[model samples]
Target: MEKYIDIIKNSYSGYWRYLKHEIISVNHWDNYFYGLIIISVLVWVLEIIFPWRKDQAIFRKDFWLDTFYMFFNFFLLNLIILIALSNTVAAFFNDILAKIGLSISSFQLFDVDDLPKVLGLFVFFIVSDFVQWNTHRLLHRVPFLWNFHKVHHSVKEMGFAAHLRYHWMEPVVYKSLLYIPIAIIGGFDAQDVAIVHFFNITIGHLNHANLGWDYGILKYVFNNPKMHIWHHAKALPKHVRYGVNFGLTLSIWDYIFKTDYIPHSGKDITLGFEGDENFPKQFLAQELYPLNLNDKKK
Candidate 1:
C-alpha cells in the first residue's frame, strides 16, 4: 500500500537524520581517536616495563584478533547499532510507560539541565556506572546472556586493546537497558555523554591493561588492572565466587554486593574460561560461536 511505502520511506529518513545529528555530530572523532592512541601507547609502554606474565610475549596468541575486535567495535559495528537502535528503543519504553498512564519524565530525579555542568557530569557518571555494573553482572549471571559475554572472557591475554573486545550484541543490550533509566533521569545532552565516554574509555583501557598496579586504598574506589585481572581468572576454587568483581569503572559496587576478590599476588592467576581451551580463536568463529546454543550445555 502507498501508506506503508510512505511509512517506510519516512522511517528511513528519520533514522538517517538521527544518525547525523545524534551520533555523527556528537561523536568527537578527533578526541576519541587521539585519546585512544595516547592511552594505548601509554599502556603499551607500562606493560613492557612491568609485564604481568614474563613468559607472555607482546604479540601473544589472538593479539591481532583482539585488535580487529577493537577497530570493528569502535569504527563500525557499535556506531551503527547505537545510531539505529537508540531512538526506537527509547520510544518502545516510552510507549509502554504511557500505556500504564506513566511517563519517564514523571520519574525525573531533578532537572538535570538546571544543575551546574560539573555536578551534572558527576550525577550522570554515577548513575550510568551503576547501570553498567549491573548489566555486566547480568551478562555473567544469566545463562543465555553469558553466551555473548564468553567472547570477551575468551581472551587469553589481557591488554589495552582487550578493553574494546566484546560481542557486537553487548552494546545493543547495554545501551537499550541504559536508555530508559537515563531518559527518566532527564536525558543527558551530547556534551555530558561525550565526557562520560572519554572517562569510560580511559578507565576501561587501564582496567584491562597488563599493568600490575593495585592503587592500594584507591583500588576500593576505582577498578584497576589487578582487580579486573581476577575477573578473567581461568578458574576459582569452589568456595571462591565464580563471577566476582563485576565493576566497570568503580569497584564500590562489587564491594557492596560482596563479589569483590583480589589475591595478594596475581602472577600465578590463570585467565580465560575453564574447559574452553578449544574455543575458537578467529573473530568470525567467535561471533558465531555464541549462536551455537548447544555449546552452553557443556
Candidate 2:
C-alpha cells in the first residue's frame, strides 16, 4: 500500500506542476490584454474629469475601434508572425539586419554577464521611436503616401475608437518598418519586445484619446494625447506642429532634434490632411489612397 501511495503522489505532483507552468505562460501572454483593460478603465475615469472634444460620437464610435486596434497589435500581429514568418522569412530578414549593423538580437547585442531591464526597455523604445517618428513625419512630407496616411488624420470625433481608425497602411508601416531594427539586430528577448508593445499600444491610444489625462512633464517627456491629436490636425500649412512630440515613450530625442510642440491655449484642435478634405475615410479608400501632394488633379 505504501508503494501504491507513492505512485498516486507522483501522479498528482506531475499534474500540479504542469498546471502551474500553464498558468504562468497564460498570464504572460494575457497580461497584455489585462494591461489594456486596466488602461481603458483608467482612461474612462479620466474622460469624466477632463474632457477634450465636443463631438458626442467621440464616445460612441471610437471605443470599439481602439479596442480592435489594441487587440490586433498585441495578439494578431504577434501570433501570425510568430507562427508563419518569424522563424522563416522573418529570421532571414533578422539575419540580414544584423549583417547591416542596424539592430541586434537580444541574445547577442546584450552582455550576457549582466543586463539591466531598464536599459533594454529604453533601447527598445528608442530604436522603435526613431523608426516610427521618422516614418510618421515622412507620411506628411511625402505626397504619395499621404493618401493612405490621411485616413488616420480623417478622424474628427476624437475618441478611443478614433484612435484605431487608421489606414491599414499605418499598421503595415508600424509593424513592418518599425520592427525592422528590432528584428534584424536580434537584441531583445520576448519580455523586452512585449513591454515595448505594451507602452506603444497603450500610450499611442492615450495620446489620441478624447478623454483628457494630465501627463504634464510626461507630456514634455513623451508624446501625450494632446500632442498626438495635434499631429492629426487638418489646419493650414499642414506642418508637423505638435510633431515635436515624436518619441513614443521618451522625448529626449524630440527635444534634442527641436521638433517638440506644446500648444498654449490648451484647446482641442482640428486634424486632417491639408489638401484633400474630400478624400474618403473608409478602409478601402484609405488602403488605396495617398493624396499625392506632388500632382494635383487639375
Candidate 3:
C-alpha cells in the first residue's frame, strides 16, 4: 500500500518537474513542451502561408478545442491520471517478470548497443513506426478501440494542433503495443531517440495540417498532407470497410500493404465518420463517451 503511495508521489513530483522545465525555465531545444510549441507554430505558419483550402478560416472550426487537446494529451492528462496509472502498471509488470526470473533486458533480438548512434536510431524508428502503423489499423478495425479513436476523427478541420487531438487512451494503446518490439531490441530508452521522436512529431503535424505538400518524389517514403487527408475522409471506398492509409509516420507501409487510397485530390473531402455528428463536441464528454458506447449498443 505504501509502495503505491510512493509511486503516486514520485509520479506527481516528476510531472511537476517536467512542467517547470518545459514551460517556466525552458533550457533545451529538444524538450517536448518547447519542441511541440516550436513545431506546431512552424507548421501552422506554413498552413496560413500556403493553405490548400484557401476558403478555410485562419482559426478554423474547433481550432481552440484541438489546441486544448494538444496540451491535454501531451501534458495535462499525465498530471491528472496517466502518470500514476502507468507507474503502477509498470511496477506490477516488473514484479511479475521478477517472479519469473526475467527482466526487460532478458530478451534481445539483436544488440543495438554497439551500432552507430544514427544507425541505432534508424533501427528503432523503423520498428516503432511499424508497430504504430499496425496499432493505427487496429484502432479502426476494432469496435471498442474505434469508439475511443472517435475523439480524433471528430475533427472537422485540419490543423497542426489537430495532430495531437486524440483520446488519452491512445498513448496507452500505442505504448503498450510498441513495448514488445522495443524491448526485444533493448539498448536505449525513449530519450536516446529524441531526434526520431521530434521528427515524427513534425511529420504528424504536417500530415494533419491544411497544407498540400507531398514531399514530391519522397511522398513514397514519408507521410504527407495530401495522402493523409484521404485517411480522414468521411467516406471510405466501399471495398475497404475498416480504413485506409494506416501509416503513422511513413507512407511506405500503406503502399507495400496495398492499403493506400487516393482516388483523386482529397483537399475538399468532408472529414469524419458516418455518425460523427452525434459524437460529443466537449472535451470531457468526448473523453467519457467511449465508456458508454457498449451501453448504447445494448
Best-matching candidate per TM-score: 3
Task: List residue ranges in candidate 2 displaced over 4 A.
Answer: 1-26, 54-114, 183-185, 236-244, 290-298
Off by over 4 Å in 3: 189-191, 294-298
Per-residue lDDT tens digits of candidate 1, residues 43-79? 7788888887777788766778887888778756634
Error of 2 at 52 (Å): 2.9
Model 1 regions more than 4 Å off: 1-30
> lDDT by residue for model 2 over 137-215, one digit each (tens)?
6766665565555666667656654555655556565666755566544455766667777676667667766655547
Candidate 3 residue lDDT tens string, 94-203: 77899999987777777678788888899999999999999999999888899889888989989888999999999988887877688888768557787898999999
Q: Rank the candidates by lDDT, best first.
A: 3, 1, 2
* Global lDDT of each candidate: 0.79, 0.58, 0.89
TM-score per candidate, in order? 0.86, 0.69, 0.95
Of 1 and 2, which scores higher on lDDT?
1
RMSD of each: 3.5, 10.2, 1.6
